[model samples]
Target chain A: MVKLTEEMKTAFSKVKIFPVATASKEGVPNVVPIGFCQLVDDETIWIADNFMVKSLANLEENPNVAIYVWGPETGGCFQIKGKATIISSGEKFDKMKAIVNAAKPGLPAKTLIEVMISDVFQCAPGPEAGKKLL
Target chain B: MVKLTEEMKTAFSKVKIFPVATASKEGVPNVVPIGFCQLVDDETIWIADNFMVKSLANLEENPNVAIYVWGPETGGCFQIKGKATIISSGEKFDKMKAIVNAAKPGLPAKTLIEVMISDVFQCAPGPEAGKKLL
Candidate 1:
């Protein structure tokens, strides 16, 4: 397990949207743009699923997920990969629901996906690109 | 194979960055933010490899790739999934290298990734989210 560094945390906070990717057990891949992804803690991230059908299905079949975030202003990019768990009714889910409702009203926060970070990688294009940070 | 619609083409043109995802043969997934992704034709896309390590490795093991693009201004998001072919030296590679150099100088355009789009999906959050566009 790897913890997010301060720079990684700051980069993620600056991102308004994230592109999340997941694969089926058969290796078919899917990617979607998510607007409600937030870091719950250094080692944990929560994604409020508003209208995700394929992503949820893929997660059910395979727990592994990768989320890509980039800061437009700072030109910083990072990818966080981890195992995901779906939360429908729980304290974490409730908190995520409330937060999602406050930010974007009327959308049902159908599920909260909790990702436990296993690895972090630099995504910016350079020598360090794709290098594992943790 | 699915061809891109006018709206999808326009949405991709409006994007300055793209988050591309690929999985290895073993099903390990990776996502990275790419700044040099462009649509070559309605059914073809090109991505200049400035500094991609794991993404390239994953592609070698599995040709399937998913690229996510969203327009911040129009609020349109789309995912294009296809099989990728890497071009090291060819007409396509030369064109992509010239374009990459003209757009962002000083970086080596190591490879040109050509994607033959097989499927397109709407990524916007709504009733149609995750719906296959083609």
Candidate 2:
């Protein structure tokens, strides 16, 4: 299985905020910074649904998503593309809630988004730019 | 006409890199960190395409784009949604080339993407979160 490289995981772990992209059924694109995006296993990602509005709606209409990973502490930049599953109840969802509420008391973290990463691309500007890593 | 607020413009200007979102005609979402995303006017943005591949292809297939603006110096966060027009040759394209080449000589600065801002939304978490401003 093509999973996140150690360097990519290290970069993903250090960032507190993330930019998640989604598109409506009609194809309108939306991107927003999310704070509760977490790594789950090798090819999975967990995003707590706390403040999502249009993003959630878009996801319901279209499961496709692309997440950008890069920032000050991150040594490199990458784009992770995946198919998302919205989970409102279940063991994983409950675990996500606990993690979220622990970070901020009273936070609902209403839902959990399970993203199955299918592709990873290099975003660094160079000859390897846009190269698929997985 | 709705456009970027002064505060929003200020936030957009200070960022060294930006997250730009686009989708394929098939509705698959893609997001990448772009260093050349620039504010052109009240409702326009100029992105010098020094190195864009999938992003450019996505734009060609679907003009819709979403850009996330936020960072250390930005007081707040916002998502700028727009329709992109690609220009490979033109006066504005020439101008973009000069600006891009000035920053990095010998760069191709391949194309110019002009984004016409159609909607602006709050990305901050709160009651006003996800509220459209434009």
Candidate 3:
């Protein structure tokens, strides 16, 4: 509902590792650490891959996914809902790899999965001050 | 797949809040946090609800969802995937509401959406020390 600011984006960028949640048709789910996920545009977020694991499989089965960018100890969080498009080879994949590699050096550029966000919002009341639209 | 320990569960419990992500057919996704999500069983995780917003709607349309429990600052994270079942009124709802209200006092029991987890895994490497089976 609120705009995602530059500060929030910078904070997100600093967070380096984010937890990605993926699920299948039968209500089975897997949560794992993703090396990189970046905001491609106002409505899209991309996640890179080394092991084409659960999130990728779940995306192939169903495009819907939820990404949580906060911890229990940390006071704030960002939650996004969107459809995941699996891009193993393409310009989009290349672009994502570049961004990820730039942020996190030395990591191999494996497959990339981009989550085109449909909605973004804050979980807690006041990270409001941290948002600055980029 | 590493185990979820008593410490992880306790840490997750202390985190007080968690992120929930959801999506629909068009590849649009929304992420938000509910007051509580507890491990109902080893393979099942339940999320409570108040707004009944995107996640509830997405679940109704499609049961697939991914929940991320991590922050940029906090070094560890948990990612889980599973099918979401909207339980408006039932024993499950009542049970979830009790668990949530007990942890976070004063919130009304609007509705409870249980995400019956199919898989559970950590997002990082060395919090490897944090897995314990309840």
- The predicted structure with the larger TM-score, 1 or 2, is 2
Question: Who wins the TM-score comparison?
Answer: 2
In Å, residue B58's CA in model 1 sits off its true spot by 0.6
> Per-prediction interface RMSD?
1.1, 0.9, 6.2
- Pitting candidate 2 against candidate 3, the one with the higher lDDT is 2
What TM-score, over all chains together, does every model reach? 0.94, 0.96, 0.60
lDDT score, residue B10, model 2? 89
Report the interface RMSD that candidate 3 achieves against the true structure, in angstroms: 6.2
| Cα lDDT listed for each candidate | 0.86, 0.89, 0.61
Tens-digit lDDT string for candidate 3 (A58-93): 678877766656644444666655677788788988
B42-121 in candidate 3: lDDT tens per residue? 55677767554555666777776666556544456666656777787888888877876887677666677766655555
Q: After superposition, how far is residue B40 of candidate 2 from its true place, in Å?
A: 1.6
Compute DockQ for each candidate against the true complex: 0.76, 0.82, 0.24
Off by over 4 Å in 3: A1-11, A21-31, A40-46, A58-106, A114-118, A125-134, B1-16, B21-30, B40-44, B64-84, B90-95, B115-117, B120-134
For model 2, report the TM-score of its A chain.
0.95
Rank the candidate models, highest lDDT first: 2, 1, 3
In candidate 2, what are the lDDT values of residues B33-78, reduced to their tens digit? 8888888889999988877989899999899999989988998888
- DockQ head-to-head 1 vs 2, winner: 2
Please give the fraction of native interface contacts (Cα pairs under 8 Å between A and B) kept by each candidate.
0.74, 0.79, 0.28
